[model samples]
Target: MLLAIILVTLIVLIMLRVPVAFSILGTGFLGLVLLGGLGHALPILETAPATAVRNSSLSAISLFMLMAQFMLMSGLLDSLFDAARSLVGRIPGGTGVASVGAGTAFAAVSGSSTAAAATLAQTSTKRMLSEGYQQTVASGLVASVGTLAAMIPPSIILVFYAITAEASVGDVLVAGFFPGLLIAIAMVATMYVGMAFQKGAVPAGQRSTWAEKWKSLWHASPLLFIFVAVVGSIFLGIATPTEAAALGALVALILVVARGRFTTQKFLVAVAETVKSTAMILAIVMAAHVLGHFLTETRTAPKLVQAIEDSAMPALLVMVLIAAFYVLLGFFMDQVAIIALTVPIVLPVVEELGYDAVWFGIFMILLAEVGMITPPMGLNVFVVSKSSGIPAVVVFRGAFPYVVVMLLMAMVFLLWPGLVMWVPNLMG
Candidate 1:
């Protein structure tokens, strides 16, 4: 009955448009007061925020967000996209493919999916459309590639997953590298196939000269260096994730300033944006912590885990169900809010099933990336649509093939866990 109330109330509050963090916190607090007394609930609330913020691992989020902001404001995204265009523009649907490539590269530096979609949309969508690309194709490409922001190293979601799962942030970050790239490649391939079957869908264009390609490549080298320095150090154990983030942010700032892109105005905007985004994420984390405490006190996670364990279905089937749930939830919830609210509940079940937390984290993120492109409520879809003036349905159609690629990728990870485990294993 208590679980029923908690679940129902949370859904009700959410449907009423209450912010997810507040809805979870409010429902949990009310449950605690009713079930365990106000005395118990008050202390938990007071401590939860402090405990959530005290995590040094979480500091990486703000650092990475700031770095992303610097990169976005400083025109690094533009450079990368230009280089990608020069290199791939000759192929069918090449601009769309290049958008995915650029987003993948930007993801290494900018950890936010929405920011990636926005930045890439601002940089490439209009141009792609102007180049005679289909509107749906242009918008869909941005929405799908934007999700790479969450899969790539330095992802804010990965940081939260590390803290919640008590896994290494660096390990989770490193584990993401190959899988992220694989998804990017798959997305590009999907574009190629889509264009191939539907002739004239993506107009072919002239290829750049080798010199022009090299110049484009030269302009993007700063981002390449930052990626190697930051991701490479973490993967090689030369620096902790937090230290790497700080170092990355410094490098990003320098690149922006050296390029004369950073004005006092731009610097202040980046700082302000970072603070606002960080505060929003932190608030959700704190609230989710309070709700997590309540769930733990009630033994909700264990109960669910036991039920799953007793079920007749194979563990793989259960995993698929959970992934599907994330897809549905992703349609309506922000990725961070979903992570904060669901991980505490679902992770125990994942562990009981004998999957590595790091692998599961990667899988979960890949599922969430689908949500970012999936529907009436897929945030990235809306972001790209708004930026590109393309209809949401068109973006949805464009992203449909990529969604299949993601689902297939999820199955691959499930069947061959080595795809995700290989990197972390080697580092060990």
Candidate 2:
């Protein structure tokens, strides 16, 4: 009964526009106090923040964020996009497919989808619109592809999920690799096919000479190398995620220096942004641990799992409902908040049904990313709209096709499972 009321209060808080971290923290602390007394609630609130921040697994977040910042500062992201566009821009969808291609590459560098979305919005969206693509397609493509960052390697969300679920961070990161690449490939194919029916949007491009293509790729090689070093090292079991991230940040720093873009001010700005971003994530992490404590003390997850088990619903059906539930949560909540708030609750329930912890991490991220593009509170859509000067509704419409692509991909991997886990299996 108390758990139900806490959930109700949480919903009420969200509906009232309370900040998510606070909503979660307040409700969790309240529940702890009411159910187990202040003796229980007070200790968790006091310690969770410190404990969560000290997690060795989470150190990668700061390092990866720094790497992203350095890449952004060095203008490597622009070079990478141009390089991708040069390679794929001559295709039927031109900049649209190129955006997906570039987004996939950018995903390797910036774990934050908003960073990818804003970059593409400022660069790709304008070119796409000028190429005669519909505003919805143009804006939606950017918004959709930007979400690639969430599932691709070095992804902050994947790290958060792994830490919360007590899974191997490296395994979780590796698991997302194949599915993310498949989704990118699907988005590219989707773009080509979608453009086929758009009539006037398909324009023949003057294909670049091999020499020019090589030139663009050569210019962008540093970004590629960083991505490879980070991901390859992980896949080969040559480095921990934190070590790989540190290596990535170091290489990105050197790239900034080589480009003559390194200024003390710029470096400090990157550091500041990294700190700010990490701080926000850590606060939510703290709140999650506190809530996780409450849930654990009350044996909430065990009871819920037991009840669902006895209900005798097929495991697969329950899993589908859970996937839908995550998508529903995405519509209204931020992805970070959703992961922070629910992973503690849902992970155990799913694991109880024999789901792989690493697979669930990727599955959770993919579903949560739908919220990033869906209506009412789509974060990526708003970022694209603001940066591209397109209407949010149009961006939302634009993103719908990609959203469908993601959902279909989710179901595919869920059924096959191996498609999502083979790379991790290889790593093992």
Candidate 3:
């Protein structure tokens, strides 16, 4: 009854358009009161919020967000995209593929999918649309491909998952490297195939000159160095994950200022945006803590775990079901909120099934990436549409093929866990 009430109340509040954080916290608090009375619930309410704020792992969130914000405002994002375009612009549907490539590169720096989608949408979508690309193709590619940002290394999602699941943040981040690259490769291949069949869909354009390409490459070198420095130091044991983030942010800021792209106005704006995004993420996380606490106190997670164990479902099938649930929920909820609310319930089952926590973390991120492009509530779709002034349907249609690619990538990871485990194993 308590679990059902919490679930129902959360759903109702979400349907009523309550902010996700509030809905989670309110339902959890209400459920706690019902289960243990005001005496117990009040203390939980007071204590959980403080505990949530004091969490050290959460410091990574602000640092990473600040890094992304500074980079975006610094104009480095555009330089990276231009370099990607120069490299891939000659192939069929190359612009779209370039967007995915650029997005993946940006993901290394930004760490958030929404920021990637928003930044790329602002940079690439307009150009693609104005160049006469089909609205569906342009919008969909951006929306779906932007998800690569979250799968790539330096992902905020991976960091959060690592912290919450008590896994190594560096290991989880390293584990994502290959799978994220695979997704990008698959998405690019899908674009090539789609363009092959529908030749007129993506017109071939003039290939960039060697000189021009080299110029763009030179301009993007700083971003590459930042990536190598941060991810490399962690992999080499020279710096911890938190230290890498701090170093990355500092390097990014230096690059921005050296390029003369960091104005006082832009700096302030980046700070403001970082604060807003970070606060929103933290709020949902705190609420999730409350929900997770309630679920644990009520033994709801244990009951579910026992039921799953009793069922004769194969471990692989269980993973598929969980992935499907994420896809469905992704349509309605933000990825961070979903992770926070479900990780406590799901991670224990994953452990019992004998999967590596770091590997499972990558799997979860891949699934969430798919969710970002999947439906009526796909945030990236809305972002792409808004940026391109294209209809959401067009974007959804364009993203369909990429979604298949993501699903296929998920299946590959499921079948050959080595794709995710290899890097981390090497590091260990």
What TM-score, computed on C-alpha atoms, does each candidate reach?
0.97, 0.97, 0.96
Clashing pairs in 2: none
Clashes per model (N, Cα, C within 3 A) = 0, 0, 1
Off by over 4 Å in 3: none
Per-residue lDDT over 326-368 for candidate 3, one digit per residue giving the tens place of the 0 to 100 score:
7777777777888888888888888887788999898887887
lDDT for 71 in candidate 1 is 86
Q: Give the TM-score of candidate 3.
A: 0.96
Instruction: Give the clashing pairs for model 1.
Output: none
Q: Where does candidate 1 have its weakest 10-residue lDDT segment?
A: 368-377
Candidate 2 residue-wise lDDT, 32-98, digit = tens: 9998798877878888878877888789989999999998999978877678878877766666777
Off by over 4 Å in 1: none
TM-score (C-alpha, index-matched) for candidate 1:
0.97
The global Cα lDDT (0 to 1) of model 2 is: 0.87
Which residue pairs overlap in candidate 3's backbone? 136-394
Best by lDDT: 2
Q: Quantify all predictions' global Cα lDDT against the true fold.
A: 0.86, 0.87, 0.84
